[model samples]
Target: MHTIEIQKEPVELYKILKFEGMTSTGGEAKLLIGDGQVTVNGETETRRRRKMMNGDVIGFRGDQFHLQLSTHTETI
Candidate 1:
């Protein structure tokens, strides 16, 4: 299982797919998601803009990923 650290909460499904290099482009990511080729927490997710947060698992192309929220600290 691969771990991905996200800087914030509520990341879009397509964005994650694209940003993570799962898809070449955002459009491709959206297409794959719209075609029901993606899963969230082992369940099929077709929402292109599905809001994902920490602890969400994404499955695609037989690859699984675990999302983790990065602890951002403010510097004085």
Candidate 2:
């Protein structure tokens, strides 16, 4: 499991994929998403930018990610 911190309550599914080094392009993320290769909250995720948000758990590529909305104190 990996923890991804963001500045907002939600993050797009595509961003997660890219962040995890899954792919370099959003287009590729979409393709992987649509193929049922991505999972949101333990289910297949179809939305490219699914707005993960805080506390939203997403699973993809055999890994689970916990999304946390970051504060100014936190650095990227």
Candidate 3:
């Protein structure tokens, strides 16, 4: 797992998506979300601005992350 510390307590969907290199732009994340390629807490997530609260889990493809308080860990 790779750790990523953020300046804020909670992060938006687009931020983590880009931080994980899942997409280069918010547009890409929107498309991916709309296509049901993103998962939140083990279910398909379609909200582009889905607020990632601490301890939330997000998965895409084979990548997953633990959104900790003020930090996010990328699990490969």
Task: Give all TM-scores, in the order shown.
Answer: 0.94, 0.81, 0.76
Per-residue lDDT for 1-76 in model 1, tens only? 9999999999999999999999999999999999999999999999999999999999999989999999887789
Q: After superposition, how far is residue 28 of candidate 2 from its true place, in Å?
A: 0.7
Ranking by lDDT: 1, 2, 3
Among the numbered candidates, top TM-score falls to 1
- lDDT per residue as tens, model 3, 1-76: 3444555656888778886787988788888987899998899998888888777788888777777665445679
lDDT of 2 by residue, 1-76 (tens): 8887877655678977787687888888889898888887878878777777788777776788888877667448
Q: Candidate 3 local accuracy as lDDT?
A: 0.77
Kindly give the number of clashing pairs for every candidate: 0, 6, 0
lDDT, candidate 3, residue 67? Answer: 71
Off by over 4 Å in 1: 74-76
TM-score of 3: 0.76
C-alpha lDDT of residue 52 in model 1: 100
> How close to the true structure is residue 75 of candidate 1, measured as C-alpha lDDT?
89
